[model samples]
Target: MKHLILCCLLLCACVAAHAHKPSDSYLNLVVEGQSVTGQWDIALRDLDFAIGLDANGDAAITWGEVRARQSEIDAYAMARLQLQAGGKSCPAAVTEHLIDDHTDGAYVVLRFRALCADTVSELQARYALFFDIDPQHKGLLQLMYQGQSSTAIFSPDKATQQFKLTQPSRIRQFVDYGREGVWHIWIGFDHILFLLALLLPAVVVRREQTWQAVDAFKPALWSVLKIVTAFTLAHSITLTLATLGVISLPSRWVESTIAASVVVAALNNIYPLFRERRWVMAFLFGLIHGFGFASVLTDLGLPKSALVLALVGFNLGVETGQMAIVAVFLPLAFYLRRTTLYRRAILLGGSILIAILAAGWLVERVFDMKFLPF
Candidate 1:
């Protein structure tokens, strides 16, 4: 029974790992001198989203729902935005006017108002929008600005960017769409793991290459760098292509193939399958990663004109994610190379772990097993 429970536990862990998301993010779109610098924070939540069309015909949190959950959303957004806004802080002298609003659904109707002050010159704000459904449900948002209507669809249900101050006289923002609070971290588990896998191998590769020649330590690091650069270049290429919708592949295939990649790399370690042409493998695997990125853009439902902006923003998020993965793993590789014992342990342990994972995934994906789905 203990053995059976262990198997079940492992099975559940795998599912949970794969089932994870990047995080519930908090977005800050700061407009400076007619330019924008966006930063993000992530969080989690047990709430649903509320959607209502703005006066300009943009989709936003339902006004009624806003009134009901105003305190909840505001309290949630305040702490983060306050820190992010630095000395700016929340706006003063703003009037909250309740306005009646309606939506496609009966429950979508509600009354809410914008809190703005003309004399404030800047606005910092956050609000929770609940839809009584998981963010994974089908969702879309439409906004009207300068008499032009724009739409953003986020299928598989997710939060959105906020418009704190909409009036032209008070053009300011505090919280951004798609960013929540700390909750975002837990949701993005797969994103973290995928990034970890990518960075992990390069770090290991660099360390192994270093011990090959006693005097070639620096050169070994360079080789590792070359490999990392190659991988980055390859993935970045596909990330752009996939996000732009130029290259489309089935999500299942991409994910399944991703698991296969870990397998391939593990096998290569045992015997030089790719044989010094690992960059080729990285490039090929990157194509798959790019497809994974496309899945995110697909979720965003960005418009064609804003396509470039959204594309850049989403890609930036991915780049930051990749950099973080490297930051954590690279230095550890250097440390491991210092001791032969540690090196062997890493090799044996990492190889076995990767192989087991790959095997589990291959079984689940290739055969459509009920136990685990990679």
Candidate 2:
């Protein structure tokens, strides 16, 4: 069982390293009468992965390299998306190509126009970009119709969506953004790992270079509550502030620091630097993690009129998802606390492994390099 657990941890660490930054592309579409015009911003790193934007293989992509392959980029992207109006295809064409920067990295911006045969009341979009190469990639869509906006997330499971070219529904926006928040937390392996590193020792008390399971459940529960509450409060504060544009940080710095925090949190388990006071680590690191969470909302561009509602819904969704994780993890961890597997194999051995994985993530995020196979 211990070996099986170790294997699972190793596999999870490998997978989490690949998921340091979830893959995503942004699309903004406008509908008017019988025409649709929009811009799509896809990460240059993703584009390079799909179509080899770095021609000379110097590990750096230049404008010359991207310019030379404009045609290929157009063909590759446009072919993957199809717009429909009133059940008829509105053949699309790319009008311009440019570069833009998002919180994550540089993006390839494609401005295009699509015309239909008649007036459009309802619009359908088919998006399959990068699904073949990177199944985890998601397309984030923002639609502007009749002076209102709606957003949707497209992935391999749900590649097509329809939008009504009418007044926006605030409820719809709230629900959609909420679901997105939940999805973001679920796939955020780095965030999950960081939280787990903090929680691993919650049910146990550290004493003299070793760990022992607590005698009662109340103390363990209280310990978990403090850690979770601190993390939630910290991230919630920053998530709101960052999403509201009150403050901002570079994505690379935020991501690198988040990874470093994970390294410290996990290493502290083996080293017992903070011993019983893990909540301090959670609150401090969670501030950086909140910035990481804000990337999705920042890229989607929050609704002006419904800013507070959207923010509340997204934050609630994040909390709901986080609580669900704790629900599952707390029980299992409490059960395992009394075992030798938990004290020696998981706490000691697992912390060392998590630290190593987080270290790799730190190197990757800070240096902007891909060392893992995935």
The model with the greatest lDDT is 2
Task: Supply the TM-score for candidate 1.
Answer: 0.53
Best candidate, TM-score-wise?
A: 2
In model 1, state the lDDT of residue 128: 31
- The weakest ten consecutive residues by lDDT in model 1 span 169-178
How many collisions between residues are there in candidate 1? 35
Every candidate's lDDT: 0.43, 0.84
Q: What RMSD, rounded to one decimal, does every model reach? A: 12.1, 2.1
What tens digits encode model 2's per-residue C-alpha lDDT throughout 27-107? Answer: 999888998999999888888988899988987888889999999999999999999988999999999999998776788
Model 1, global lDDT: 0.43
Cα lDDT tens digits, model 1, 139-174, are 333333433324333333333333322432111111
Alpha carbon deviation, residue 208, candidate 1 (Å): 13
